[model samples]
Target: TQGKEKVDDAEEVKFEIWKKNSDKNSSMLEAKHDQHGIYTAKTVIKEPGTYTVQVHVTARKMHVMPKTDLSVN
Candidate 1:
């Protein structure tokens, strides 16, 4: 027997990119999603340093935020 599953809603995904120790230079990532629930955003780094990328997701009154460090040369 197969079980039925329902997807009432989906989580909103967003990203924030900024250089380390700099708050004024932060920018929001414009992400696009496909039918497979994959989100993607494109950005260009003009400086060479350590940067932070944060992924924010919200769904059903719940929120999740994850961050990572990135370096560009």
Candidate 2:
């Protein structure tokens, strides 16, 4: 997944991934500075299951950013 963002004020942005089926777990995949906010993640799914991707943008405050769903076959 790739896109552009227009932010008024922000210090940092984070990209993360996790197994959607599992509730007690989350993984930190990548992080980027507020200025150079370009990022990518290399993830491995062990089982055939659903996964989630979230982008967290933080500056003066924090936001949930966006979410995505992935299916491993």
Candidate 3:
């Protein structure tokens, strides 16, 4: 979802969520691939704060990391 291109069949995707101030407060979830190369991950945020969501993609012997900020009310 972070990249413009579609994911390849051999690629592996992971979704990571973490608190902005703490590396220990992090969660990693494996993404499920759907039709049309869409990858999805669901997580429940119990705390209301600023967090970072990163997409870790591995494909073609390379790794790509894309991250975004998320604020949960």
Find the candidate with the highest lDDT and give its number.
Answer: 3
Q: Give the C-alpha miss distance for residue 46 in model 1, angstroms.
A: 1.4
What is the per-residue lDDT of model 2 for residues 53-73, given as tens digits with 9 covering 90 to 100? 887876555555788998889
- Worst 10-residue lDDT window, candidate 2: 32-41
Quick one: ranking by TM-score, best first? 3, 1, 2
All candidates' lDDT scores?
0.73, 0.66, 0.83
lDDT of 1 by residue, 1-73 (tens): 0124332344677788889988647888766665445577887888999999998767567777789999999
Clashes per candidate (backbone, < 3 Å) = 0, 0, 0
Best candidate per TM-score, number?
A: 3
The model with the greater TM-score, 2 or 3, is 3
Off-target runs (Cα >4 Å) in candidate 1 are: 1-9
TM-score per candidate: 0.72, 0.58, 0.81
lDDT of 3 by residue, 1-73 (tens): 3367765463789998998888657799999887777788998999899999998888767788889999999
Q: Rank the candidates by lDDT, best first.
A: 3, 1, 2
